[model samples]
Target: MEPLDSPAPRPLAHIPAIPIFDPLEFDRSLPSSQYTLIKTDDLRSMYREIGRVQAYLHNLINRGDDTPSLAIDDSKRAKTAAIERVPPEILSMIFEQAVPPQTDDENPRETHRLAEILLPGQICRLWREAAITTPSLWSSIYLKFSFPKNSVEKMVDIVTTCIARAKGYPLSICLWNQSDTELTQYRPIIAVLLAHSHQWDNVFIKCGGGPRKNPYEELQGAKGCLSMLRRLKVEYDEIEEGGSFDTFLISPKLRIVDLRNYGVQPWHEIGQFPLLPWRQLQQITFVGYIEDALELLRMSPILRVFKVSVVGHSVELYHVHHAFLLELSVESLVDGAASDLFGAFTLPALSSLSYAGEEFPRDAITSFVQRSNIEQSLHTFSLTLHERRDTLLIPSSNIIKCLESMPCLSQLSLHDLSKRYTDTGPFHSGDISSICERLEPRPILPKLKRFSITGPPQMSCVYLALMVKSRWRRAAGGLVWIESVEINHSRPCAHAKSSMTQIPAHIESRESGRALALLRLYRSEGLRVVGSLVDEDECIECIDEQGYGAFDPDEN
Candidate 1:
C-alpha cells in the first residue's frame, strides 16, 4: 500500500480507453476478482484524494484568484440583458401601473404613494430617468399638514418640487389642513397652489378647526386665477357672517363645484354668496338651505346634473322651466318640502330622477312627471325608502300610474334605504307581483330591459319568473328578452329555517315546480338571474353603489 501522505497517482496517458467487458454478458461472464478490486481500500483512497483536490480548486476560485463560476457570470449577464431589452415606453407604462390609486382624504406624511413613486428613481440611473420623464407620475399631489412652525416651509418646498416635476401637465390636487393655527399659517401653501391654478384640473380643499377667520380669505383678489380649472370641491369648518366665494366667479372654465358647509352658523343667503357663471356650470352639488338651492337652479340654464340636500321646508323660484337639465337627485327632504321643490321646476330634458328619504312622495312625483314633459323623456328612475315603524306602504295603483307615465323607461330599481344587513322592512312580494300583473294587461314599459329588487325575502322566484315571461316573446325569436334580474334577501336563521325552507322545499318537491323550472329555462335562454342570501354580518361595502345590489353581468 502507498504511504498516506504520498502524492496521488496520475492518469496513465499510455493506456488507451476501452470498455472492460460487454454489459450484455455481465452476469455470466463477470469474474469475482473484478468486483473485489472495485470494493478494495486502494480504490476508495483514490476517490477521497480526487474529492480533496476538487475542494481545494473551489476554494482557490472563491478567493478571487481564478474566474468566477459559470452560474454567477450567467446571472449577471441575464440581469443586464433584461434591463436593456425593456424600452422606455414600456417601462413608463409599468411605472404608471405601480402608482398608487387616488384617495379622497389622506394624510400627506403618511402617504406611501409618494414613496412608491420616488423609489424607482432612487433604484438606478436608468429607472430614475424613466420616472422623471413620465409626467403622469408627478401630476397627482396630496398636501396634508399640521401646524409645527416649520411645516409650512416643508410643505412649500414639497409642493414646488412636485409642480416643477409635473412639467406643464394637468394637476389633480387635494389639500387638507387639520391644524389649529391661525389662517396665516396656511397662506403660503395656498398661495403656492393658486399660483399654478391655470393647470388645475381637479382640486379639493378642506381646512377646518382653525381660528375664527375663514381659511379661504386669502383668495379675495385672485380673480381669473383658475383659467383652466374644471372641477372644484371646498369644505369649510366655519364661515363668517359676510364670507363669500367671489374669487371663483371669474373662472370661465369652471364646470363642476361641490361645496359643503360644516359650520354651526347659518351660511349667507344665496344672493349674498359669491356670484357664479350659472349658465356655464354643468354639474353642482350643494348642501345648504332649500331656498339657496332653488336660487342656484333658477340661474343655471344649462345645468345637466343637480344634487342637493335641503335644510328648510320652503323654496321660491321664478324660472318656470330648465331646458337642459337631465339628472336630478333630491335627498333628505320631507314629503311636503319635496313636493314644493319639485313643483317649482319644469325639467323638459330630465331623463333620470332619484329620491332618497324616509317618505317618498309618490303623488308628488306623479304630478311632477305629468306636469313636465318627463312622461315621454324619462328613462331611468330609482326610489330608496328608509325603514320606519309606521310601515310605509307603496300603493300598487301609484306604482302602476307612475310606470304608465314613463313610456321610454329602460331600467327600474327598488331598494330599501337601510344599509344595515339585518334590516327587514315593509317591502312585500305582493306589491311587486301586483305591479307585474299590471304590466301584463298591456305593455307598460316596452323598452324595459333591467329590473332590480332588494329588501326582505318577500319576493319569491315565482313572481319574478312570471314577470320575465310576460316581457318575453316566443314568436319574435330573440327580439325581446329581459337582460338581467337581481334579487337580494335576508338569510334564513337556524331557528326559523323550518319556516323559510319548508315552503320552498314542499313546493319544489311535491307541488308544481313552475317557479324553479321557469327560472332555469329563462336562464338557459340568456337571462341572468342573481339571487343572494345576505347574512347579518355580510359585507355591504363590496356591493355596487349605482345598482341595487345587482352583480355586474360582465363579471359572469
Candidate 2:
C-alpha cells in the first residue's frame, strides 16, 4: 500500500546488530576488545544487503532517468533563473565594463581582446546571445595583419564578424601591421575599415610600407564618410613619404590628432602636410620641425593644449597670438632652440610650460618670461637638461631669477642629467645648500607647494631640510605650506662609502641619521618627504608634457 519511494519499516531483530558507534567515541583510540565483532560471512551478507538497498533507492529516485538528468535540469534552471533576473539593458552595461577601458590610440593586447570580448560569447548560449545583441561590446575592433596568407583570411573573417555585430554603433578601431613584406595582403583589411568610416568615433592606424605605398590611400574616398569621427592617430614607416592626409580635413567633428613618423625620412613640407580642420581642434601633438608646428599653432586659434618636438631652429613668427592655449610643451634637440621657440609663442592664457633639451637657456627663458608677461599667470614650470658635457651647469642664480619672475608658481621640477651618474660641481651638496640658503631669504614663489629633484643621491639632507623648513616654517607667517618634497636618486651614489670603512662609514651614517630625523620632524608637522632610489627609466622627462604639471604626491 505504501509508495515505492518510501523506506520500509526496519526489522526489530536486526536493530541490535546495527552499528551504534558514536562519531566522537570512535575518534579516540580504543582497545581491541572494545571493537565491534563480526564473522566474515556475516560481514559479506551485510554488504550484499546494503548494496541491494542502495540500488533500490537509486531506482526509486531516478524512476525514468539514468545519466544525472535531474541534476542537469536543476543546473539549467538555476542558470536561467539567475540570468533572467538581470535585465538585458543591465547585462549589456556589464558587458561594456568587461571590455577593456577605451584608450586613445593605444594598441590593444591580443590576450585582452580574447578574454574581454571574445571569451564572453563562448561561455554559454545566453552569454553569446547577450554579447551578440550588445552593439557597444563589439564596437571596438583591434586587428593585427602580420599573419600568413591563410591566417590573414581568418583575421579578416573575424574582423567582418565584429563589424557586423557592432550594429550601427560608433566604433573605436585600431589596426596594426608590422610585416615589411605583406603590403598586398593587408590592403584589403584597410579597405574594409574605410568602408565603415561613417561609424568611426576613434581610429588609430600604424603600418610599415615603402615610400610610395600609402596604406591609407583608400581614405581619400572616405573623406565625407567620417561624420562621427572624434579622434584620429596615424603612424607609418618614416620611409613612406609625401602622402597627404587631406581626407581628414573633411572630418568636422575631429578634435584630437597624433601623427608619428618612426622612420628616418623627415616630415613632409608644411604645404604637403595634411590640411586638418585646425580651428575645430582642441589638442594637437606634432613631432616635426619648428616651422610646421608654428604654422599649425597659427591656424589653431582655439587650441587648448599643444605639444611639439622641434627638429630645427625656431622660426620667427611676428605678431602671432594664441588667446585660448592653456599649456605649451616644447622639446628642442638643438641647444637654445627650445628657448627660441618659447620666445616665439605669445600664449596669453598659458598656465604650464615644459622645456627639455641639451641646454637650459637661462637667459632666453628669462627673456621669454618677461616678454610674454606670464609671470603673473604661470603656475607650473619644469626644466630638464640632458647635456652630457658638464661645461656649463644651469646657474643657481639663473634658476633663482626665473623663480623670482614667476611669483605665482606652485610646482617646480628640475632634472640635471649630468648629475645623475657623477657627484660634482653645481649638483654637489655645497651648491644645493647655498641654493636652499638663498631661497630662505627670497620672497620668490610664495605659493610654492611641491618641489621635486631627480639626479644623483649626493644632495645634502641638511640643506634639503633647511629648504623645507624655510618654506613651511609657520614662524615666518606665510599662508602657503610646503606640502610635498621628493628626492629621486636616478643612480647610485659613486661616493657612498662601505660600512667596512669604519670612520668614514660612521660619519656618513651620522649625517644620514640626522637628515632622516629632520625629515621626520617635518613630516610630523604635515609635510611629506619621499626619498627613494629609482631607475633611470622612471625619471620623468620635462619634454613629456602629457601630465607635466599634474604630479601629485598625495595620490602616490
Candidate 3:
C-alpha cells in the first residue's frame, strides 16, 4: 500500500460561534449572590498593576533570583491600561466572543465549558465583575463529563454554578451522559439543571444507552416550566428512546426539534408518541421511514427544514403538497427507503434539497423541478452515492439531470462512496467521472459557486481535479465561476477496518499535483479549498474531519 501524506492543517476553522448576551452576575446555584458584600469597584487599574508585578517576578525567577524582593514606585504606573479604558459593557461582549465553543474547538481542547467562563473570571476582578453582570455569558451551559472522571461533586458544582449565573435568563444547554459512572451519580448534576427547567431554551441531551430509565425522564417535570424552550435535541440510547412527556408536549413557543430515534417501537407509534405543539414548529430532523416523514410534514405545515433518515421501504406513493418548507434532506439508514420520500414531497418554497439513498428518484424530482420551478429556487443540493455491487447506487444520468435542472444552484456536494476499488481488483469509476465531466460544461448549473466531491481511488481524483481546473476558467456564458472545491479521496485499506487521516498525496501524477497547487492558490486568493484524503471508508467522516463544512444539507 502507498503511504499516505501528512493530514493538512485546518484551512478555515468555523467556531459554531453563534452567541447572545452572556453576563455572569446571576447564578441560581448559590443561596444568594456571593459577591453582594464585595465592593463593585472597577479594578482594571489594579489588574494592570498586578500583571506588571507578575511578569517582573516571572522574569526575575528565570534570572535565578532566590529571594528577590522588588519595590516599585506606585506613582510610576499608568492609572489604567488602554484596553481597560474600554467600557465594561463592551468588554463583556468581547469576553463572550472570546469564550471558546462548548464543542468543535481543539486549541485548548476543553471538555467542560465551565472552564471557558471560569478562566476569564480568574483573569481579574474587573473582568470577573463584567462577566458576572452579563447574564447571557453564563446561559449557554455545556454539562459534559471529563474522561477519567472529575469528582461527582465538582461536576454538580459546575452545572449549578452555570445555571445559577444564568439567573432568570433562558438557558441554552448541552448535556453529555456517556460514562461508566452509576446512574445515581449523574442524577445530582442533572437534577441541578432540571431545577431550572423554566430557563430551558435550547437543550441538547445525548445519552449513551444502558439503563432504560434515565435522568432524561427528569425532563418530564419541565412541561409547564418550558415556556422559554425553543429548541430541544435528544439522542437517546435507541434501546430506550422513551418519551410521552406530560407538559413538554405543550410548550407554547417551542419552534425546533431534532431526534435520533430509529424504531417506531412504542414512542413512534401513532397514539403512543408524545403530543408536541407541532403546528408552531419551524424545523424538524427525524430518522425514520417515509411514512414517519409524512407524519411530521402533516403536522408541521410551516416547517422550513426537514432532514430525515429513511429506515424501510414505502413504495406506495402518498403525495404531500407543502408550500412553506425551505430545506428537505433524506438519507437511508436501512439503505433503500429514502428515494420513496422524494415521490411524496412537493415543496415550492424549498431552497435546498439533499438525498443519499439507494436510488435517486430522478423522474419524480424532475417533475417537481418543473412543477415548482425549483430549478430557479433551489440553491444547495447534495447527493451521496454508495456502492451496491460492482456498480454505484445512483446512475450517472440521474445526477447529471438533477444538476442540469438546478440552474440557480449555488452549493453542490457529490459523494462517490463506492468501495469496489478495494484490493486492486476491478476499478469501477462509479460514475464520478461522468458527474465531473457533466459539471465542466458551462451554463449547466450557471450559478454554481461551491463544489464538493468524494471518491474512492486514483482515477476519480485525477478526473475530478482536471474537471475543476477546466471549470475554474468558465467565466463567460452567464456562468458563476466556481469559487470553492472540497475534495475527499479514499486510500486502499491495508489493515482491516483501518482509519487514520492522510495528507494530500494519493496520486503522484504531475496533472494531479498541478490541480492540487491550483486549489491551494485559490485558497491563497481568499477562496475556500480544503481536501481530506484519508484511510476511512466513510465519505462523510472526511468532510466532518475537515471542519470547513458539513457535506450534508446544512448543519443540524
lDDT on C-alpha atoms for all candidate structures: 0.62, 0.64, 0.62
TM-score (C-alpha, index-matched) for candidate 2: 0.66
lDDT of 1 by residue, 305-366 (tens): 89877665654445458888888888765546676677777888899988777776777788
Tens digit per residue, CA lDDT, model 2, 512-532: 334434455566567786755
TM-score for each model: 0.66, 0.66, 0.62
Residue range 1-556, candidate 3, lDDT tens digits: 2112213432222223223322334474334454633322334445556666666655654453354435455698768876667789997788767544433111221223666767767877787888888777788788655434457777778678777777886677887765553455566766787788878777777766555434456566566778777777776444333444445676887877876657535333543444578888888888755676787787788988887887767667578889899888878776456556666767888898888865566776777777776878999998875567645344465667767788888998987656432222122254465566556554578777898887655543444544555556436767766788887654542111232233343333323333344455445556576765323243333434544221113321
Where does model 2 exceed 4 Å of error? 1-140, 163-170, 177-182, 208-211, 236-244, 261-270, 314-319, 387-391, 420-427, 430-437, 475-479, 490-509, 528-556
| Candidate 1, RMSD to the unseen true structure | 12.7
Number of the top candidate by lDDT?
Answer: 2
Error of 3 at 270 (Å): 4.5
Candidate 1: worst-modelled 10 consecutive residues by lDDT: 103-112
The C-alpha local distance difference test score for the whole of candidate 1 amounts to: 0.62
Can you tell me which runs of candidate 3 are displaced by over 4 Å? Answer: 1-137, 142-158, 174-195, 206-217, 235-244, 264-270, 315-317, 358-373, 386-395, 417-434, 456-474, 488-508, 517-556
- After superposing all C-alphas onto the true structure, candidate 2 shows an RMSD in angstroms of 14.3
